[model samples]
Target: MFDVPLMKKNGSLFAGIALLLGAFAGNARAEEMSLQQAVEIALQNNAELQAFRDEKGLREAGRIRAGLLPNPSLEVSLESGALTGNSGENAFSVGVSQEFLLAGKREKRVALAQKELEVYRWQLTDRERLLRLDAKSRFYQVLLAVRKLKLTEGAIELNRHLYQVAKERLAAGDIPELELNLVQVELARSEGARSAALEGLLASRAELSLLLGGKEVEPALPTGSLEAGGAVKQAQAELLRLAQERRPDLMALRAEAEKGSAELSLAKAEGIPNLTAGLGLKRDTTAVEVAGLEGKDTSYTVGLTLSMPIPLFDKNQPGLRESSARRDSAGNRLAAAASRVEREVAAAYASLSNAEQVLSLYFRNIMPQMEENLKLTREAYQLGEVPVLTVFEEQKKYLEVNQGYLDALYQRQLALFKLEAAAAVELTGGVQ
Candidate 1:
């Protein structure tokens, strides 16, 4: 897959303004779109994928041209005068000649061209697949930014309410001025966080817009569940195997090397001789006058001429050397591609494993514990057995856990994307 580098934070802010335009319109217009439909639109319209499709057409054209034989040439010669018994006479003769290729050059070229076309076809397919996955990844990032915005917004509102309560308590001499200041500080922090999240959401939407190759994408997120299809452990081996079979970039490199090999062979074969043979009918005024020779009665001449290029100064020596070097270079690139793919797949699996474990922990232990602790602390504070400060601390911890849960969920989904990219296969059946 082609690399989509991470956006620099400060630089991203300016770039993302266009991303928030739709959201602004949505706020003003109350219209938004679902994520799945957005992904479908992106896949259908992404400019990069469309460009690759154009490239595929060129490769196919090359294949068609390669299958054709060399065109024959017509030759003409004229003698101004032919002396017969001191009589001035002139005759012109015309013939056609064609050179047959030696050492199966045409077939080899067609084979190489066919391979090139196949290589391009796979590259196009791979790009389409990556574009779809990229759109989804960007979608999740936008959602995460929105989700974080909501959390911060909630936190700010709660802190503002608590600050008012503390103000009342201080007025009644129930709490110190320092406690009210602390609540005000918390409220300020929450508001700052909300602004930061809003900025991130804007930037994320812009990045997503670039991926979609358009400005029509919106920030309203879909809330449906992502079904994790197969067990993570089972999918690991499956991904590795599929990558070996289906990694198109690697296959393209191999095809390129094979094409170079064929070029080298063609260069070596260039020194070989080819048969230039032709058949022709000839008619002259003298022949017509002497023997009543007409078009059909003209005598036929058939012969073969052997032609070859000498190994003097330039006997395809440079071409062979260049082709051989390129073939070797392509072979090295293929080797590197295989190594990189292996590492990429392994790293993706490791990340998937760790992310799954993290999500499981958040789901089975941390969130439940945080929720239970918050419930008990709320009860205690209501009974006046514990101070409201303890209940507030639990409340903060519960919110943090909720944020962590969202982080785990998005991280796992991103890991799944990476794994499929490395493997170059739909190991999860289809992306959600």
Candidate 2:
């Protein structure tokens, strides 16, 4: 006896342990990720976003530096006796001087820095939004590629079976050799398609990984469907208004304009020359013989000095003109940005509408009809009532129509993302 009952018990325990380990591995590989997680990862790890953060830090440093006062200067000097005279004397003096701003130049400079910091803040936000769009687009592309690969693989399997059936019919003299050759050609084409789909899927995954700021990422399926959703209900006018109010780039441009104005004010204030004041102390000592007795004398002296430039030249006129030009430029740029936003929003809306219409045509009319035709043609071909070529053509037509529908779905989602980008707000999920 081999301890049959004890052997079964140990086998059962080992099987259960293996299954548990497999389940854990499966869970680890799947790593269910949502669109929000993808965007968050990009924001956290993206190199460009990191650079923007550093730039923001620099702007903050500028603000701190602008609010500080000018440093005082120390002056020291030593002098000795005249060249020819025997009256040897030595004296030393030390002074401290500070330049005081005449107007509110310090305040103006600080205000300018503040405005620049605000601009950088908005720019960072804009950059994050753009990266989110990129990540979402790449994520959806991976999903599309995976779906395409599945579709091609299925087609390849079906075609292979059909080719085998055709070969059997030819050997039995029930189908012509021409039909078998055509089926073989279709099988070859399907295999090629499968290869292309596999390549595309790999490329798409790589792109998504790059966007996620990873050197490489595990091959995981996107957790979503490409189902179409409700149409955009907001009026175009309302969308344009929202874009104007919310777009981060527009806000940044406005901030830049304010900064320019502040800079101009600073330039004007700087034209008022600063006053420099100095204070010093000196000690003098003397030795003399008075009535045959040696006597010593010491004295201390205090001196004050004040000075200012006459502003006759370099009165900051050029700086004023430059700042004025920049302000005007910023105004023009703001107007252009508004127009660009309007155009982008209108274009995206139109594209979304067109994609939705095309999708409706395919799903409501074309797809059902194509599927029915393929089913009927395949049945007829098996009954020897129709040729194999007819069935093959129907299959091809079905594949083409479905592929077109997939493209339309992707376009709709992409248009929605573009609209969000233009409006500088969250619109909808990339895929349904």
Candidate 3:
């Protein structure tokens, strides 16, 4: 009987544990989606990236078709001649000829086409990275706006409580009417601020949706360890290395320069003359003393014929110079981009340091003092040592710290993104 009762009790206990575990797992799933998932979805469906893909495909097709040999020409002729020999005699000839390229011009064309293919491929990579960065920037904007709206709502709630307290105090003749009115006015202002921030948050969300392949996909609000989230700890050398190795814009510049080099090669090869070889078939009739009336004769001739373009009028020197200039311009652009990237890295680093310092002040110094003052003023008011207005002032100070903290978070994230855009690397939390 004891074993039976214990077994039933154990079953109920196990069931209770199972229910708690299930609820916890369900909450975890509903709360957050990692940034990596968002980035992957954007990449697969992003419209701008898809456009680059199409552009690259077009370039590849053009390169392939460009390698083919030039088509040969066909020639046909009809001639009539009369040679008088005592009486009247006539001779007629008809012939057809076909020509084929004898020069190795096709091989030279193939070389130039291979070079062009490299340029377009790099251009495609550069556009893809820009699109990814754009998406990340917009996503952060939405996050920042939402954070601000929450801060505003929190402020409004604090003001509402203060207003209620002021009303009670004024009715009891403990506080003046003007003090109560001041709290009411502050409450109204907080409400207005919250409404405006809510509108801005919605607008930011809409902007993010447009960039996400023109579709709206709502993301769950994210929360992280804010202490280290604002740390932009990447070294300058690391950023420079990433810029050199993976930056899409720089790669595009290099690709264009290579394409220019290919163009130069083609221009030089154009100076070489192309030769065409021909073969012909002919028939001669009415040969004197050798053939009778209605005699049929067939003659075939195999000859090496060369037809080449004259290099006398144009030597392609001007074209060669233009291509060289383009190559030089591309190099200059690449250098400028490198310098600009370094400057951007420096600027972002400075901003990050400043934001971190300010954030520290609010977290470590301002918030602590504000919270202590609020408690002290409230206790004093209850003891008839301080007025209700004093407590309300302390409460407003705390709300100000909250707003400042939210603003600092937004600024820090923006600085990080600017650094990422310069280094051409994906942010740690911005993969999606």
TM-score, each model? 0.76, 0.88, 0.78
Query: Please, what are the lDDT tens digits per residue for candidate 3 over residues 39-82?
Result: 56577778877777777677677767876655655665544344
* Residue 183 of model 3, lDDT score: 78
Model 2: per-residue Cα lDDT over 118-148, one tens digit each: 9999888888878978988887786567556
Which structure is stronger by TM-score: 2 or 3? 2
Using TM-score as the measure, what is the rank order of every candidate, best first?
2, 3, 1
Q: Where does candidate 3 have its weakest 10-residue lDDT segment?
A: 1-10
| Candidate 2 structure, TM-score to reference | 0.88
Cα RMSD for predicted model 3? 9.6
Where model 2 places Cα greater than 4 Å from the true spot, the runs are 1-30, 82-87, 216-220, 285-297, 428-432
Stretches of model 3 off by over 4 angstroms after superposition: 1-33, 79-108, 216-234, 286-303, 377-397, 427-432
What C-alpha lDDT do the candidate models reach, one value each? 0.69, 0.76, 0.63
Instruction: Look at candidate 2 and give me any clashing residue pairs.
Output: none
Pairs with steric clashes in candidate 1:
none
